[model samples]
Target: MSEGASFRTYFEVEGEDRSRLGAQVGEQRRRVAARLAEIRNVVAVMSGKGGVGKSYLTAALALGLARRLTRGVGVVDADLKSPTVARLLGAAGPLALSPEGVRPALGNENIRVISTDFLLADGRPLRWREPEHERFVWRGALEAGVLREFLADVAWGPLELLVIDLPPGADGVADVAELAPSLKGAVSVTLPTDESYQSVRRAMASAQDAGIRLLGVIENMSGYRCPSCGSTEPLFPGSAGSRLAEDFGVPLLAQVPFSAGAVEVPSGLLDRFLETLA
Candidate 1:
């Protein structure tokens, strides 16, 4: 009973069709490798829970990096079921695909964008009215399959950075690592609430357990300023970002204030954060 023969025999004994699926999986992995080879750096922008503006932060980072690089940057909306990269960046429809590979749409800042939104039946931007629960309903295997395709099939070309906006949780961590082994680490986002801090702590634990480096923490919507009184009020007072940084042994990158401005990227906060990265 050699190891190779035993492996095959075990699958046969279980009456599972292993060869066909194994070949497909192997090909998908190869495709992922080919695409990742062209990208220099990969970052998984993640959080413990939703509504912390993780996707927006990922977009801002991508745009900022694009502005500094001649080759531009790439962002894959890895939240397959609830993708918002296309809508957040206002990227248009009609994905360009050829024998070479699938082309990611260009955003306002010239950053290349890829999301499951482009793969919808009509290939149009996801509507705000549509409930996310209605769009994405799948188990872990299907979710991994979609992510694998995003990495393998998308024609990212040459990119300074490939910022992946992972969904809120640790389930997809393995898929991201397996698909893109060159991933540098994760940038965890959180709010100023106690709940957010706990969630972020769990996210950090997951990343560390997977051997992924913690780039730093970004505290978004930390405070707001009153126009009439000129008084600054902390939105989530006593933000745990600093404590998280200290406990996790990672830097506190930025505490971005909330703003209603229409700017795609907050220049001041983003600039400061980029400096730390340098």
Candidate 2:
């Protein structure tokens, strides 16, 4: 049989019938199993609220791991409501779909990316009118079957790690906790501000409630360092990284300084990310 024909036959046998409830459950199980088989580590980057630089950190972490480690990495932009990994990585290519499954994501350094942006028509607004609308989008994207298809059916190849950039707040944590039990841990991001700290603490608590391990806390825009004088000043006044780490019993991985170059997505931001990883 042709390669495409062979793939179709395999998919038919493996994928459960969409109409049946039992089949749905089986499909979910298969997808989760497939994800477990493929990726070695799955890290969810989350925050209690938006503007904590969660998505930026997710992209940076994936790139960092991929560039430094021999094993490859994939990033799932689980922030369905506001997917931005595609834009961050500059993946504007059309998604290839076949009877076998969806093709591997196209982006910088072979970083496999899947986001709700890929599913939408050009310029279509994803804003939900009601709570149910939001839930449907979330369920469709992150639930077992769709997630499995993204993982199993796609040509992700072998990955050492898969970093998921979830939507900001408790909703994102709940989504991953409900879907994937293999979540290795979460890296909560926060700014050095009183409000940001309180919000991030709540997010950490949500992860704790879900039994997800807190790998560390990353303090973004913690302080500004003067290149000429070497003087440092708090941009947002608060005890965030160390204090929260002590409270939650997790490490303070790094305090990322307020660098305009660090936050920009394109224009050599990947190189800055590598430095941070180092």
Best by lDDT: 1
Q: Per-residue alpha-carbon lDDT of model 1 for 1-278, expressed as tens digits? A: 76665354554566545567777777778888888989878888888889988887887777767777787788889987678877777776689978878888988787788888776755465343434574555445566777887788888888878889998886566569877788888888889888889988987897788888888888888788566775768787667678788879987877767766543465465555555455
Each prediction's RMSD over C-alphas, in Å, is: 5.4, 10.3
Tell me the tens digit of each residue's lDDT in model 2 across 1-278. Answer: 66665445635676655668777766776666665576777778888878877777777677666666677888887776678887676565577886655665767767888877887767785644446655865655544445555545666666787788877877566667556677778888888888888888998998898788888888887788777786777788887877888999877776777665543333343453344333
Candidate 1 Cα deviation (angstroms), residue 239: 1.6
Q: Give the Cα lDDT of each candidate.
A: 0.77, 0.71
Q: How far is candidate 1 from the true structure (C-alpha RMSD, Å)?
A: 5.4
Cα shift from native, residue 6, model 1 (Å): 12
Which candidate number has the best TM-score? Answer: 1
- The residue pairs in collision within model 2 are none
lDDT value for candidate 2? 0.71
- In model 1, the runs with Cα more than 4 Å from the true position are 1-20, 121-138, 227-231, 264-278
